[model samples]
Target: MDLDFYKKQALQKQKEHKKFLDGLKKKPPKNLDYQVLETHEETFEEIDCLSCANCCKTTGPLYIEKDIERISKHLRMRQADFEAKFLRVDEDNDKVLQDLPCFFLNDDNTCSIYDVRPKACREYPHTDRKKIYQINNLTIKNTLICPATYVFVEKLRKALEK
Candidate 1:
């Protein structure tokens, strides 16, 4: 989607999310995991990530030691060299790309090192996972980055109201 479209959707989703959270706080429901997963599945059916790689273009995942080693090996470079060239330690002491539009993201929006990508990259959006209610903060962040997450929340709100 275009930047304008994304901006509009982001604003709308933000309002929806606040309303949904407020409603939940007033009358919380049981069996939230089933509700979230069902909504996620339905939303995923409609999302097309290839059309919008906003996350890869706007943010980087925290890279663990294993990710450093694996990705370094994939690039045929020493781990320290790889880290120096493409990453920096964040305030939390985790490795992340130096800037937005992660270095590994190709022009086509595909990961250049998909096989050895970080754990966080592998679990992005995190909507279909079990225990969805436990990561409500993550859901909020992902909703801002991933259209699928926005769609999931919208569907979830509908489901919860039923």
Candidate 2:
């Protein structure tokens, strides 16, 4: 995928997308969730995450306590030690990774601890989540970092227009 091209397109369309999403938030369609879920499924069928792990490369997932515990256990370390070594609290007061490109991201773009990865990582882009209109802000941000999100939003707009 041409990331530079995608970035340019996303930046150009940012305001338009945000406007559409804001409108969607005020009066979403009855089938909004269903359409978004279907669109999410179709988008993933065409896009391969392994080919472009941009989200992992550019952003950090918010690690909650359960995620910390799970990952700590998976790595055979105490939770405190894991937090000290890999996590820092952000301004949002959420625990996030210390680095981008994710410490666990392997050379092949696969996660070293995929099974024990944080919940936020698992639900990234979040287009398929219920009441997606509620997450318009997150979706807008993801469009810059995730081509799948950009495509999904475009597909969803088309789907809704019909």
Candidate 3:
């Protein structure tokens, strides 16, 4: 899928789409998780994340203590130094990146520290997980960031519409 095309489409439809997702959350189908898993699997098979790293480029994932430890160790930096240089405590009291376009994002839209990247980054888009209905708010927001998510939700909406 073309990034700009979906991005434009997402921008245009975000509000209505969010309402759709919210309603889905309120009255989730009995097979909600199964449908999401199937759609997510199919979406990811065709979409290459490297081609569109909008999640890494535009948003910062919450970095926990273990994420700090692993990433610091991988980068050969002291934990304190790493945190000081790259992180700040967000309003939610979560450790998030200090800047946008993520400091660790490479030019090719890959993560500079892929293996040691934060858990949230690894689980991004978060479409294929269990209890999918519980994260409707997040999934709605991700539609703006990830095209695959937009496609997944749109397809699922059609497949299981009430």
By lDDT, the best candidate is 2
- Candidate 2: tens digits of C-alpha lDDT, residues 96-126: 9999879999999999999989999889879
Alpha-carbon error at 71 in model 2, in Å? 0.6
Error of 2 at 35 (Å): 0.4
Reference-based lDDT, residue 55, model 3? 86
What is the C-alpha local distance difference test score of candidate 1? 0.80
Error of model 2, residue 4, in angstroms: 1.1
- Candidate 3's clash total is 0
Clashes of each: 0, 0, 0
TM-score for model 2?
0.96
Q: Considering TM-score, where higher is better, how would the candidates rank from best to worst?
A: 2, 3, 1
**Model 2 accuracy (lDDT, Cα):** 0.91
Evaluated at residue 53, the lDDT of candidate 1 is 84
lDDT of 3 by residue, 1-162 (tens): 477888788788778777877776688778888888988998888889999888888899999999999999999999999999999999999999999999999998878899988999889989988877778778877887899998888887787764
Candidate 1 lDDT by residue in tens digits, 21-114:
6666566577776777778778877877777889899878998999998889988999989989999988998889998888778888788888
Runs in model 1 lying further than 4 Å from the true structure: 13-15, 22-28
